[model samples]
Target chain A: MTEGVALLTVFVLAVFVGFEVVSKVSSTLHTPLMSGANAIHGVILVGAVIVAGTADEAGVLVVALIAVVLATLNLVGGFVVTDRMLEMFGARRPEAAAKDGAE
Target chain B: MIAVWAQVCYVVAAVCFILALKGLSSPKTARRGNLVGAFGALLAVVVTFIAYDIDNLGWILLAVAFGAVGGAMGARRVAMTAMPQLVALFNGVGGGAAALVALLELSEPARAGITRPAGFGDDGWFAYSPLAESGGHTESEILRMVDLLSTGTLTATAFTVLIGAVSFSGSTVTFLKLQELMTGRPITFPGGPIVFGAVLVAAVGLGLWAVATGSVTLAIILALVGLLAGVLLVLPVGGADVPIVISLLNAFTGLAVAAGGYVLENALLLVAGTLVGASGTILTRAMAHAMGRSVSSILFGAFKGGSTAGGGEASDRPVRSAGPDDVAIMLAYARKVIVVPGYGLAVAQAQHTIRELVDLLEKRGVEVGYAIHPVAGRMPGHMNVLLAEANIPYEQLLEMDTANGQLRTADVALVVGANDVVNPAARTSPGSPIYGMPILDADHAGAIVFLKRSMRPGFAGIENELLFDPKTTLLFGDAKASLTALVSALKSL
Candidate 1:
């Protein structure tokens, strides 16, 4: 397979895989899940890194640097908030109640 | 050699990301799941630092350190109620970064040429830049990424810029409204659609012109226009619908990030970005479905605000007002009470009070449960999270169907600071903007005691007909204060 075709194939597969993985998330966890997904896309930092590494022009480097900082903020902040929020959901007290319908 | 090593690290990071998502499915493992995702991000960043040696590496390191500290502090300090706005802001910056990635990609080739080392010839996705200057001729040639940035890739870049601008600007509006920095009510100009249309047309027109003429200035102008269009698109949506807007913008950011991955030809970026896009699309749809709104209606509804939609004399209609003592007597006497909460509950920080009330009722042998409408809180499932913070057991939170079914036999449905969710207008009033929207059917209860601040209409600006029902009692005050009063009154009884 050609290089571009391989990437396209992976992209398509990831789309299906993502849908399958997220579809079963309980309603209560939706906010954390959305925020988690938000953080993962912060992987655009990969592109930012490539840009910062390759660009020789000061203008492009500055732009790339800005991308790196902003993407880092997104990655770090999104994950941290999601973690904090999910910690509230981590209690084991709710499981027995969850087994009953509308206790 | 470096490329191969970078790819290996990327593979490990990708596995971590997948495991992170799987862990998020169960609430018990959610925090751990977030940690796993963070580990993936850290791994990717470290790999990049090792593989790429840029000119200003020290400054990059400094900026990254500052960003990490700032982000950690901000996220840690934000109150739980302010989480929606914080997420909106963070989500916007991510999109902005992706857009910047496209710009840097465009400028890189114009400055210094990009070249791939040996062993990339068999790489399917590798495209060489055509602008490479002739060097020593050998049996093999290195491929530069800048050569691939031809007019053919302009469409991808334009798409990235457009989507990123929309997500950034739209989420900014979302943050402002959630933070109360902007009026949550829909704001409309006189020629609203026309103005929005003009901005959109200008963006598309300039974007194509930039692509055709290779004018970076026109491209930047197009991005600005796209930003204007984003604001216009969201300005007229009521605050209650902002969750749907935020969800949709999440999808937009995901797609833009995916485009950035394509521009950079990074498989990990592509996989992660596309995964987010897919999940975000599902989330947006689920949020819309919960409210019984079509995606288009939620986006296009020009909510006219409370003043215009509710000018009638529903306020003067003599509904029986019950004091806290009287409401407490009714609550104490009920065999089954169902509680319904909404955005007002969150705004008043009354979830803990509600929990106390439930405990008090349960001690008296009254079965108290929460009726959880799908779109009750600011975001989908937000109410569950909000209530969960109060340590309300998960089983007590009933979905709309189960709650409505139980309401048939319920002695009293106590609605706390909820307005539109329990409104019968969605069903009975065809002319209502929220017509055809699914509601909690609180009107089906044997008796409904509504705890509200006043006779004001809900976030949708439409009056709730259920408030006027003969069997309903209006217990007026702040939700937390009213609940506290009820607790005291019930205790005295």
Candidate 2:
């Protein structure tokens, strides 16, 4: 198969997989789910790295490095914040609850 | 060529992302799902470094380090109430990164063997005689040109640059609106739609022209115009609908990334980006449904002079104002009380205080439940997050439908810094901006007591008729202070 058609095949199937995975998510998880999806797109860091690493000029290198920084922020901040939010749901012991309320 | 092992690993990481989204469907496994996704990201990055001969290794590592520290710090320090804005900021930066990467691709095709297209000016903005620069080519050389400048790749590049720019700027506007750095109300000028339309058409023209001729200047111009279009697309949306816009922009970024993946011809980027694009679209639609709004209405409703902004002027109509002791007595005597929390409660950081009040009420033999509107707080289910942080048990929080059912027999509906969600107009007045939004049914309770800071309208900017109802009493103060006062007053009783 040609390269373009192969990529298109992956794209089409991924769209279906995406829809099926989150289709039944309850409204309560919408916020975290959106946040998680936000982090997933940070995979663009791979493209940024490729561009930066292959850059033949100083200016291009600088711009690509900036992209790297921004992608890192998106990927790292997104997952940490989501984990913190979800942590609230998981740790509901008596001691944890008292500590949270005391603050 | 990248090794076969790397391609297989990319497939594995893609599955991890799919499982991540799947696990988020239920609260029971959400955190683990996020961790799993993080692991996938780490694996993908490691594989890329190992498989490719990347240059500027030291600089890239330093940049990654700086970004990691900044991201973790921001995530750690932000209060739970401010999470929507933080998410907007993170989404914005991701989009900005994608746009930058696409712009770089115009001058520097990243793959080892691919050559940069000819006729790039020194400043990287202009191109002169792109076709003439490649003259005197052999048959195989011409064929190589055809492969490098394929219509599909150029179209993907155009899509990436435009949509990525739009997502970046749009998310920034949402962040500003949510952070109250800009006006929460829709800001519109006369002939706003015409101006927006003109820019949008120009952007599309530039995109097509760039795709056909592979002009670097035209591509840069498209990016600039896309930024303006993004700002215009979001400036007219009111505060309550901003979260939905953020979701849509998140989806926009996802599609942009997917196109970026196509441009780069990397399977990993393609799969992950499309997954996010599809899921973010579905989530945005679901949120709009929860608010009883259509996606188009939420976006362009302001352009048609629809109900976008409400009059912010406080009404002079008399409300039966009461003191803390009176509210305490009302709560003390009630058999069952329902608490309707809103954004104001979060602004005052009153979740813990309200939790204390609920605990005291329960101790006094009053059954309590929190009525959570689907669109309450800043985003969908944001109130639940704030209350969960305050250690409120999951069972005490009731969704809109269930809470509405129980409000019928509840003795009192104590609305703490909440207005529009309990307003009677959503059910009664067709002209109201929030008319069709399903509310908490606070009007169905036996007695209604509101703890408000002022007589001003709610976030959507419409005054609530329930505040003036004969059966309603208002205790005016900050949510935290009022709840604390009520706690002391109930103790004295």
Candidate 3:
């Protein structure tokens, strides 16, 4: 009936829907799924920044500031690391030259 | 007016998230998906700031600057091999942040008197929400009562933080092992089971105590217990099972994040966390089935005894040895060839070389395809990702079920750095650990060429019975070097 109750109900349903999507996907896609989801940490960054800016209380403000920093690090750092790892698989080897001549 | 714009931006961000997820489902579009997700995140952050009602500009700027510098440094420095470890570390941070947020909300002085809705009324629904408002109860009194009840939000947060921290550390260890920075052997104790049982009991007991007393201190102790439990849980698992363990730990991290999300009442956190948790669980289950092991058996380290070296008596029988010249000549003239990859290919970082070798074979009018075992490397689908990176065609990368039937019809089965996946032990010995686990029948082919570093046992810690078969010929060397030599010899022919 109330706004709070409505927010809570929607939140609960969104989580359930998210779980359903995860269950239906194949296991072979796990790594890529994670790489995609890790980017979503940026949402946490947004939340942290908002909380930091708006909270009047000193304690809340301090915590929000810390959260913002951590969340940003996670978002950017995770992508960089994942990209570098993917590069290892994509790089062409020097020995490939020998195979080229042979073919 | 700002709220309206912010809502619009949120909608846009949600769309981007959906599209990013769809793109990431296939390797060809994964990079684009990553970029789209990043843009969505950037949009969400900028929009949130625009709508935020903040009076203190100084603190906000400092936080942003610090976040930017730290993030840039981490991104620039971390290696690709350590990406999974970094993921674990970030998962820990997310869970920890959620736990901290929940605690701060509960301890807020302004919201001190708000009581738990009477409608909830001991229904045990709030059992997971430790900080649920309880009417007519002082903070200290409620804390004491919650300590006694232990099943509330505090317990959930504590458990999440504890598990997340352990996953972070354990994943780092696994990354090092995979990269050859650490030994791939299983670290086990003489009485590992008893110690594991004790830790589990302590963790549960302390968790209950923290809930009953609503004591944050006790919750912290419970967290430590969980942290130790995670380390103990993973240490005894051998190299062969690392992929499954990594998948399982990924699941644990996901569940922890979801718990934290529930505590913080954040919709995005819940959505992302639940998605990761459920997927990780399914992957762990699939990997376990592929290995012919139960989840419980993996957790308790009961499968170690079956992984004996030299268990295959047939390995003593003499087998043929093939030089690169002979093998290349045969392959160059062959109509069709199927390449079976194993951990050895991964160890030598030879996927690119293999890809080149395949190209050479194709130029000779040979139909070449790859046979992928479900549990080939340290992780599920490890070979697929590696091969895909070399720009291998999806049509050529065949699953075991599809590829197995074709192996017998092929002119040659050129197994590169693979072992147990092609071993005949799975079929011949019902008593073996990998007995029922499906394998590629490389022996059934007209000719078999095994490329291996040595005669060492594979992940199961047992000698491959296929290695000694009369039909199989051993071509020993580093996979990259061996494949290169084969290419040269083929060109000479």
Provide DockQ values for all models, in the order shown.
0.46, 0.84, 0.33
Relative to the true structure, how large is the alpha-carbon lDDT of every model? 0.78, 0.86, 0.64
Can you give the lDDT of residue A64 in candidate 1? 80
By lDDT, the candidates rank as 2, 1, 3
Report the C-alpha lDDT of model 2 over B1-493, residue by residue, as the tens digit: 4799999999999999998999887999999999999989888988888887799988988988898899989999999989999999999999989889888776542222233344322233223314344444544434434444556777888899999999999999999999999998888889988999999999888887887667667788899998999999999888688999999999999999999988877899999999999999999999999988889998886324655434688899998999999999999889999999998899999998998899999999999999999888989988889888888999999998999998999999999888888988988998887878888999999999999999988888888899999989999999999999999999899
Ranking by DockQ: 2, 1, 3
Retained true contacts (fraction), each candidate: 0.71, 0.83, 0.38
lDDT minimum window of 10 residues, candidate 3 chain B? B113-122
RMSD (Å) per prediction: 5.3, 4.2, 6.3
**Candidate 3 Cα outliers beyond 4 Å, as residue runs:** A1-16, A23-28, A38-73, A80-103, B1-23, B26-36, B47-152, B290-292, B309-319
Q: Estimate each model's TM-score.
A: 0.89, 0.94, 0.78
Docking class of 2: high
Interface Cα RMSD for all candidates? Answer: 3.8, 0.9, 4.3
For candidate 1, lDDT tens digit of each residue in B145-242? 33344444566677788888888898899899888898877888788889988888888887777656444566677778778888988898775788
Better of 1 and 3 by DockQ: 1
Candidate 1 has which clashing residue pairs, if any? A2-B124, A3-B124, A3-B125, A4-B124, A4-B125, B114-B144, B129-B144, B129-B147, B130-B147
| Best prediction by lDDT | 2
TM-score of chain A of each: 0.83, 0.90, 0.59
Q: Is candidate 1 or candidate 2 better by TM-score?
A: 2
